[model samples]
Target: MNDKSKSVKFFEQLSWGIWIWSFIALLCVSIYLSVWAPLGNIAALLVTGISFAGFYSLSIKMRTTTKIEGQMLISNKAKIDLKFIKSATALDAEGFKRLAGVDADPAAFLAINFWSKTGVKVELKDKKDPTPYWLISSKDPKRLVKALVKAQK
Candidate 1:
């Protein structure tokens, strides 16, 4: 069973003015290449098309939902759903321990490039199909951890 205490959502969208300006710039560049340099036009068009497609794919993938529940962490996206089970804490534990038999700092190891600046750490469990455990950085880190602890109980 899962008990969702909090939910976070993130979206990627440019402002109207920025989007318009970007479109205009693209149009102008396309015109210049098509008239002034026909050979380069094909390469430019292909590159621009690929770039737009890549951005669109990234935006779609970035749409995600993160839910922290009792002993479970859930990350949902358009393609797949990931689940992570919490590890048991010791009688006298300081912080989250590294995965079984693995000697790496969970914080440094799970730090991803795209979301690293957000101060979030995501570590995978040691199981065959291990789930990812995340330590998200928040202005109120204590409060967030407390909330997760309360939800576990």
Candidate 2:
């Protein structure tokens, strides 16, 4: 990690623990089915293991972390320069929904997770990019917006 970079993870570790528990439940179902079906214990385990690996891999990919490094906002889907960012504001649940839904710009980048109801809305200053802003979900929108403002300076 760079000293100047501020990292904010969108999900709590406990939330990720749910995924692990879900995987265990799936494996249990597989084991139970193996007893009544022709698939057998080994086959059931193999199939469940493979499926779980793929599911976990995708879950890891979907987990997003936002990083404020120097003048840039870096994440899985977008990298935006703070120089082009006119403002960063923390949104309430209603504001987040409104900005992400009816009032949203068609060209703006969005990295949203259904679990997170509040977010940070970043307005782009550069007219050439076509994207008016970015709406990114965050567990702590206030801290994220603050970090963005600090990085801008």
Candidate 3:
């Protein structure tokens, strides 16, 4: 019943929200050093290069990925088969806030990243698993839900 070519696959990469500004600040620091400090051209270039590399490494390390590969739904923190999913509901900002706060289930698997406020809640049907559902933060909840639903079928 499965066709690999037609199977729905979605991949999303989420970076730390403040990284861009931090990177810009790094560049500004290098400029300041080059202009104000009595440093050789090679020294300035080396400092800038090393700073950029360090910032880039930090950004990559902090990034998280959400992927739907064939029948599997993969998050940075967890993964589940689409067949085990019973339902998925897309959440807006208010709903996400409430469920993630007061109404949250302790047993739920949270793949929440604080940066993105919108998300999807996936309910599971697997009897063996104690976890009630998965709360995942997604930039595009509707599209993620649609992809999951399509893959499940």
Model 1 misplacement above 4 A: 1-36, 40-46, 62-65, 69-71, 76-103, 106-111, 118-143
List candidate 3 segments past 4 Å from native.
Answer: 1-8, 18-52
Pairs with backbone N, CA or C atoms under 3 Å apart (clashes), candidate 3: none
Which is the winner by TM-score between candidate 1 and candidate 2?
A: 2
Per-residue lDDT of model 1, residues 33-143, tens digit only: 665465566676776666666656765554444445334444342121223324322211113333221544433323122321222334445566433444433323344
**Candidate 2's residue-wise lDDT over 16-86, tens digit each?**
44656676677667665865388677777777677667767766766867777555687665787778989
Error of 1 at 149 (Å): 2.6
Range of the 10 consecutive residues with the lowest summed lDDT in candidate 2: 8-17
Candidate 2 local Cα displacement, residue 100, angstroms: 2.0
How many steric clashes does model 2 contain? 0
Model 2, position 4, has a per-residue lDDT of 45
* Clash pairs (backbone) in predicted model 1: none
Query: What's the lDDT for candidate 3?
Result: 0.83
Taking all chains together, each candidate's TM-score versus the true structure is: 0.37, 0.78, 0.74
Which candidate tops TM-score? 2
Query: Per-candidate RMSD vs. true structure?
Result: 9.3, 4.0, 3.4
Error of 2 at 8 (Å): 10
Span of ten consecutive residues with least summed lDDT in model 3: 1-10
Mind sharing the TM-score for model 2? 0.78
